[model samples]
Target: MKALHIITGLGVGGAEQQLRLLLAHLPVDCDVVTLTNPGAVADGLIDDGVRVVHLGMTGNRDLAALPRLVKLIRAGGYDLVHTHLYRACVYGRIAARLAGVKAVVATEHSLGDSQMEGRRLSTGVRALYLASERLGRATVAVSPTVADRLQRWGVPGPRIEIVPNGIDVARFRFDPLLRERTRRRLGLPEGAYVVGGVGRLTAGKRFDVLIRALAELPREYWLLLVGGGAEESVLRRAAHDAGVTDRVLFTGERPGGGLPGADLPSLTAAMDVLCSPCAEEAFGLAVVEAMAAGLPVLYVSCPAVEDLPPSAARGARRVQGGADSFVRALLRVRAEGAGPRSVPDAAHHYCITRSAAQLMDVYTAAVSCTSLGVSSS
Candidate 1:
């Protein structure tokens, strides 16, 4: 089937990267549209031979793009229009309906109990989301927790489909030589215990908590902060206040642009342990990548890993509370000398191939149900 995928912007975030991976595996003709700032991921998508259109939306109030997007959908003759991220889900669903597309699906990649699209929680926000969600055939949740959150936000249970986020597992396997090379490249001292955290340096990511926790750990334990956002300066200051600035290394944003850059897997391999302190994570993509790299993970609470079977999360520790809780967990892990633990089976469970197959099923089922005049909701 012909499909058109829409997203807010083709930045290097998890949702954007996930979209690129999903398109590679989807068994259908597809094109992509970015509403604004066609960033680095846009280049990667173009390299992969995917058609990407930048709508040049001025801001959230740019309603003129609606007709233009609808025209593109109609001209492309796409049978299905699947959207990712918030702005795309809202506008894409409306445009799909206006364009007379029968199958419309939206993947909720970052929704949480306290936030949506990095905005504060409010009834008006939920009302807007619920209104747009009703126009779609199905809302795909990246995890069961996200599905439950949607339900709590007033989306019907039947309308929410749980499709956990997937990763290219083999791409992230541990490589001792590569790890050593990466450590050397990053100027990390040999034999220093490395504690790593991935994702945007946003307030929601709570990277400050990780820095604080790092202060509580011994000097030999270093902190690696990956990804980038507006909170970098603040986090750096937090590390300074905690007197761990020298131990903290910020890699900024690495988009994995098929160049000689420090990619996620290599950076992941360089870490002795992966720490995710984000309390409201919809799906822990970094945590899964770390697992694929055979690194023990200490997550404050990630529904993505928590929902997995025990065997898949064999080396992961789910600690609760706040920074103090994380500090205690990190101390315990360091004391035990938590080494790389193999979890090859986790790749099977969170593989992109499986996610692609499941999504294809959702697309086919939604279209078939529409053809049969049955309500997807």
Candidate 2:
């Protein structure tokens, strides 16, 4: 079936990258539209021969863009309209209805307990989201954790589908040569313990806790932070204040653009451990990816692993508290020594192929239900 995927922007965040991976595996003709900045992920989509259109949406209240989107959707004659992210969900749903496309679906990729896409869940935001969500046939939550959040936010239980985010598992397999080369490229000593943190460097992510924790570690212990955001300077200042600036390495927004040491898997190969300090997380995708690379992970919260049994991701440990607690955990892990562990079952469970197949079922159900003229109830 012909489907058009709409998202707020095409930045290098988890949601954007997840959409790219999903499109590669879904068995359908699809095009993409980005409402604003067509950044790295947009380029990757184009490189993969996917049609990507920038809607030139100025901001959230860009009502003019709505009619334009409706016109585009109507002209495309798409059978389904799938949206990702918040702005796209709101506008894409209304535009699909105006464009006469009945089969509409959305994926809630980054819905945390109290925040979504790093934005606080204000009363108005909840009301607006619920209003637009009603226009869609189904809303896919990235995890059962997020499905619960959506239901709490007033989305009907039957209308919410749980399609956990997936990853290319084999691509992240631990490689000895890659590990050596990537560590050398990053100027890390062969035996140095690298504490890796991958995610958008936002205040909500609490990357600063890692910086503070780094100060308590030995000089040979290094901190590798992947991804970029508004909090880079804040994190840099924190690193400086902690007197561990020299040991902290920040790779600014690597989108796996074929860079040898910069790509995520290569960086994961070089890491000794992955640490996610964020107390609130939707799915903890990075943690899963790291586990796929056979790296041990420490996190404050990760629904993707927590929702499953302990054996699903044996290498991942959930640590409570802040920098002090992280420092203690780091010390314990250091004493145990760093080595590649067995890739946990959790990594295999979230394989991109499986997610693609599950999403196709969601698409099929939405389309068939819409054809019957049944309310998306």
Question: Each candidate: what lDDT?
Answer: 0.86, 0.92
RMSD of each: 1.8, 1.5
- TM-score per candidate, chains pooled: 0.96, 0.98
Per-residue accuracy of model 2 over 148-249 as CA lDDT, tens digit each: 989988999999999998988888888889989989999997678899999999999999999998998888889999999999999999999889999999
lDDT score, candidate 1: 0.86
Instruction: Give the Å error, residue 57, model 2.
Output: 0.5
Q: How many residue pairs clash in each candidate?
A: 0, 0
* Prediction 2 TM-score vs. true: 0.98
Candidate 1 per-residue lDDT over residues 261-350, each given as its tens digit: 338888988898999988889989888888888888888768877787777677888888777888888788778875655765765688
